[model samples]
Target chain A: MDRATTETKLINGYQHEFPLVPRPFQRIGESLGMDEDEVLALLRDLQDRGALARIGAVVSPRTIGTSTLAAMTVPPDRLEDVAALVSAFPEVNHNYEREHDINLWFVVAAPSENDVATVLHNIERRTGLEVIGLPMLDSYHIDLGFRLPCG
Target chain B: MNRIAPSPAIDDLDRRIVKATQSGLPLVPRPYHALAETLGVTPEQIMDRMRRLLAKGIIRRIGAVPNHYRLGYTANGMSVWDVDDAAVAETGAAMGQLDFVSHCYHRPRQLPIWPYNLFAMVHGRSREEVEAKVKKIAALLGDREDGHDILYSTRILKKTGLRLVD
Candidate 1:
């Protein structure tokens, strides 16, 4: 396979069911007919380009820690500033400006619920905007990962 | 909010492993071996623990998390729906079966201000495509879909994965 084809396979094939062996990359390379070093280099390139987040386990939500989907209605003029403040908290991950009255959306994850509450309270106090906490009541989807269209 | 039953099998070592690799595994030939060194465990032990975690569903999957935007999935919409409380479970489960719906969840509504309870993330190459998919969801809900709105993320101020706090 050529470079682009190889890259596509590396992504589409290994999104799930990645080998758990000690030399997993080696196994992957063997399957792709490339050496271990080549596979590692390709993965590094993908990471550098932000194409791949990581090659690791996607932990289930609220399994190791508690988290909630929080949103805030920041005035249009203060959107950027408020977003920066919200994103500053280490607990605030995956923050985005959605198109809605409650525009600033983010996820606050912490080892404990108390820690999560502290972050939310601090954000509310600093921004002077009410944070709407929409915690997940239940999850209906068990399957994760998108099925990429093959090139 | 629904509370998940804490797995009795997870221990401090598992937490340590999660903290180490929640972002990602090392991009090396022997990734697990490198992780074992970092966590002060043998490669076999690390691999064993990971296997068990996967079995227990603590770890959803161990592989590449592709950047959706980079993959040409730019039109991402958070489709929110106000379904009847009695039928949300059934509606959400069916919605999740749609190939276009990446994530479907039942979240509490904030009343008067926000009335949506079901959230489904729909991705497409264009907004039209996403809207069409949302239409399918609306049809799926039928009368159960009291009301709905799709929130398209305008800017990604922060894009880090969930990290475990110390």
Candidate 2:
């Protein structure tokens, strides 16, 4: 396989089928007909280029901790200041500005429910915006990684 | 209210493995061995725990996280809908099964201001493609769907994966 083919395989194919073994890279290399050294180097390069976000497990929020999707409407003028303040919280991992009346949206993940409450409370007080929790009541599909089209 | 049943517990070694690899496993020939040395465990021990973790659903999947933007999925439309609360489960399940809907979740609706309780994240090469997908969702939802809106992300202020600590 060529360089582009290998990258596509690494992105689309391996996103859901990483070998769990003592030397997982060796397994990946064996399958790709590339040596361990070559596979490791290629992965390192991809990471450096920001083409790959992370090669890790996607833990379930309910099993690991509590999390809630919160949104707020910050004044257009204060959007920058309020976003920066909200992003400063460790719990607020994803803070995005979407097109809506309640523009600012983020997710708060914590080890416990109390911790989540504390973060939301602090964000409310600091930003002076009514933060609404949109916790997931039921999740049917949530595969975060998307498959890249490879020809 | 959804009552979450307690899941099977993971022991100390499994927690250690999860913590180590949550950020990412080192891109190396013997990544498990490298992690073993740091955690004062054998390579086999680390591998064993990882195997169990994957099987037990603690680790959803071990895989590559393809940067969607880099892969040409530049548009991410989070389509939200106000559905009949009584029949939301059936409608949400139907929407979730759609091919283009990457993620579908039934969330609590904020009254008056925000009446959307069903959220489906649709990704595509263009905003038009995402809008078309949302239309499909609305069509599938039929009369049960009260109102729907697509909130395409204008800016990514901050994006980070779930981690134990910053």
lDDT of 1 by residue, A32-150 (tens): 99999999999999889978878888888888888999999899999989999988888988999999988999999987788889999999999889998998888888756777776
Off by over 4 Å in 1: B1-3, B6-9
Model 2 has fnat of 0.73
DockQ of each: 0.70, 0.64
Candidate 1 lDDT over B1-53, as tens digits, reads: 23355534579999899888888998887888899898889989888898898
lDDT of 2 by residue, B1-166 (tens): 2333334677777777788888888887778889999999999898778777777666677889767776678898999999998998888878877878878889988888889999999999999899888888877878998899999888888887776552
TM-score of chain B of each: 0.94, 0.90
Name the candidate that leads on DockQ. Answer: 1
Sort candidate 1 into its docking category: medium
Q: What is the alpha-carbon lDDT for the whole of candidate 2?
A: 0.83
Question: Against the hidden true structure, what lDDT does model 1 obtain?
Answer: 0.87
Cα deviation at A60, candidate 2, in Å, is 1.1
RMSD of each: 1.8, 2.1
